[model samples]
Target: MSDLWLFSFMDDELREKIKIQSEQTKAVVYSKRTCLRHNFLIATSKSYTENSILAYVDNTEMRSAVKDIQVYHMGTDILVKWQINEVPCKSDTFRVQLLDYKYQQFAETQAKDTSTVLFNNTSPEGIYHVRISWDVYSTVRNLYTHAVGLENVNHGVPAVPHVTDLGNARARVRWTTNPHCTPDLIHVHFREPSSIGLLKVIPGTDETTVITGMKQCIQYAIQLGFSYTTGKEYLSDPAYMTFLSDGTFHNAPKLSFDQNGSLLVQWLLRPGCIVNQTVVTVETNDQPAKEYNVTGDQPLARLNDLEPCAFHTVYVTIQYKNGNVERTNSSEIHSFTKEIGLTKIKTYIVDDVLLAHWESTQNCQALGYRVDLMNPTTGQTKAYLTGEMKYRVSIGECVKSCQLLVSAISVDTMVPVTTLIDVRPERVPAQPRPPFVRRDGPALFVWWTEPNLDLTIQSYKLFVNDSKKMIRDFEVKQPRRSILLNNIEENVVYSLNLRAINESGESQPSLSVQYKWNG
Candidate 1:
């Protein structure tokens, strides 16, 4: 057995006892070794090896702490680099933790490489502490590095801004910040084209802003700047824009009614202005206001089913891009009226004259009543104008039927009422003149003349009485002047009387005439 180094300080007797126990158990002894030296002690047996002595001496120290830790701000990302005295093993890994200004760890990551990049776009502009740690031989090693201060880091100006001209004296400006840098303050400058006194400044942390109350169709100079908490400001490139105001394009619309009673409204748009939608408002007395939406390209609009004889007012508004609004002028009040027909129409005939009467029941302004007498058979019409409700027209004796139309006419519209009347002469023809009688062998001839043809006489009736006071009647269908009377007694005195007949019945008989008949 080799000398036991642990018991080397003991007496020879104790050492000899330890050696005897070691030899009896078939055990091998190991000696102490330094960290720089390699000492090997191996014990092997096929059987009864329960007394084997195994020892170890620990000389390895904890891996040297990471040195020369460095951090850099690369645009939108932060880069961390470190150096170590020894190469890392395959199982070794670095754990990086980020602490905010409050010393609170907000993020941690594991990496096998010595260098890493940290993306901190969402973090605010402030100092951050980074801690790097590793495990070596069951011992923990850690180091820390701080982000560069805001004063030492260089920042560029904000990106060039985009300007949108929203009509109605308004504009929108938008920009983006550099991903590598953070700004504590944002300032916007606006300069009018014509006036130096119109310069304005707006300060905020947002990247977009809206400016209002600008002149119409004028050019403006705009610029943006980014500043740090250290009161250092960097300005971006200047930008130019022109904002258009719709005030000059707004005008009153023309109002009128079409033939079909639809209200038509028309308006004009300002030059060089683009509109997305047009809004029309219609208002009437004792009614709710009506709204209508139409495309901006169309300048005309029509409204139907409006109340008659009512006043209405109209106005228009236009909507442009970016929610800009323009209000136009309102139209004058307009009155609408419609024509209503006449009522209570009546017609009568008396003494060969036709009379027509009607009543105006509608609330309409009329100039006068026009009466038209029409002969349907002859296709002839005659008109008469009168202010009164009743009209009288003479009809000749030969008229059979007639139509009367009474119309109420106004400056704007006209309404007519019609009626028909029978104008045929109902009286019998005048009594025929005194009939002449002539004697013939066993025959007598009689003839008569009509006074006028105005009466529609269907037939004529003649009454004859002999000398003995006996009466006999005869009829003639024609108005011929001569009629033959046969089968009369010879040399007998006869009295003849004539009467005219028509649809209205017979007329009075003519005077009796005495005649002698010879056969």
Candidate 2:
């Protein structure tokens, strides 16, 4: 009755035994008419005869090939789905293989369901081949699908852009392209330092582009984007860079004279600029111009061993490594004449005040004169500026001689003609008014009205007497009309005295004042 029974003609006993075994094992066999024409049979029992015909049925006859396989792209991922007209069993598993255009397997996955998702992380911008297979009865049968193109997938944002060959007014920008999708056009966006919120666009087919007409020493932000013909676009993050201009010597050197009468020259170095060398020329009216070479890194230069009384002109020139040369724009010709000591310097004292007079040489026009007097005994010095040739100064008491410095400044050259003199005054100044004293806690504040005089009062002296009859003296310098004595005894009455001193001698002591500390 069954296909297994058809083999009974070779052995009747075997047939009966198989019938009894089939009944006991609860097994049912399909006849030739019931099985599909392409089916193959497989033996399930091991005890069957070796010569017994065991038909092996291929699993393809029971399993159905996957049909209508479709692939769709969602963002950066690829979704695959298929249908099975007939399933051999509910527990059957399906294997899906993704291949590139070159027929090389790119991705393979197994799923128990009908649909799965794949990523395009490694695949390029082209069509892909999809093969899906299922196992039935230990045999695998696959289904081939049409090519799935990823041309319309969104590539998201591109890579950050980079700047190269940055110059004063030009720069080059480049970016990376997406391997999964090709763009119809690429656009570069940039913003200048002064033009925030305003973007400039450059369209090109290549990944690299050059931008021009940029400002020097300014920072710029650049970004790139890819656009498709279907109006989809993706923008990348911004990249920042600064542009540096060529070096130019635009600042002039400043000139001054130090205390030793040496000429000092200083200049500033501009940003993003380099200097190769500098040439300094000194020209005097009676001598030929002298040149000095200096390195670019050195910003200061000193000129020494020059005549003190001659007028000199200074010129500076700068040369860059790029074969560019520039001169000081502000007329590098500057006049520098050293100070010539004063002529016919004389000094005399009258009424404790010292009078000094001098005359400048006839060769130069004078702008003014400055006289400085120093008391060697007190190590104190004073200076006075006047347009006239005469100056009156004050010397303190018990001072026998003072050092004087008289300088006549030239109006055109600004050089001082200086002289040193020593003199002693014979007169003394009048006494000053008594000081008004006040006590605040343990401190004593003394105030006085300065004496009206034609000459300068160099200093003042304040004498204090405590309750114990101990005396202390303090000297007050010029420009200060008051003095405060701290650490005085509280609730004690203290006596104070004030006197004025000048270049000639000290004045008579003023009337005394007393104050009591209340705290």
Candidate 2 regions with alpha-carbon error over 4 angstroms: 1-140, 143-160, 165-170, 176-187, 191-207, 212-218, 225-237, 242-492, 501-519
Taken over the whole model, the C-alpha lDDT of each candidate is 0.62, 0.62
Steric overlap count per candidate:
2, 20
Point out the worst 10-residue segment of candidate 2 by lDDT.
Answer: 8-17
Give, for candidate 1, the lowest lDDT window spanning 10 residues: 8-17
Over the stretch 1-519, how does candidate 1's per-residue lDDT look in tens digits?
443322221111122113333335344444342222222233333221343444333344445546565554434544455665553332246777777777687777776754553535434457767777665434322433344333223244566678887667877888886554555567777777455422233444466888888765455777876655435566678787656545334489899888566789898865566678898898887799888888647789988756555678889887764345666788855553454544677655444565666755333466778887778788888889998889878766335666667777778776775444444444434555677777666677877776566447777778889988899888888645567788788678999988777654456578888887544
lDDT of 2 by residue, 422-514 (tens): 665534556788899876555778888865762667888888987878899999988788988887887777888887777655677888888
Q: In candidate 2, how many Å is residue 125 off?
A: 25
TM-score of each: 0.27, 0.35
Show the colliding residue pairs in model 1.
75-180, 76-180
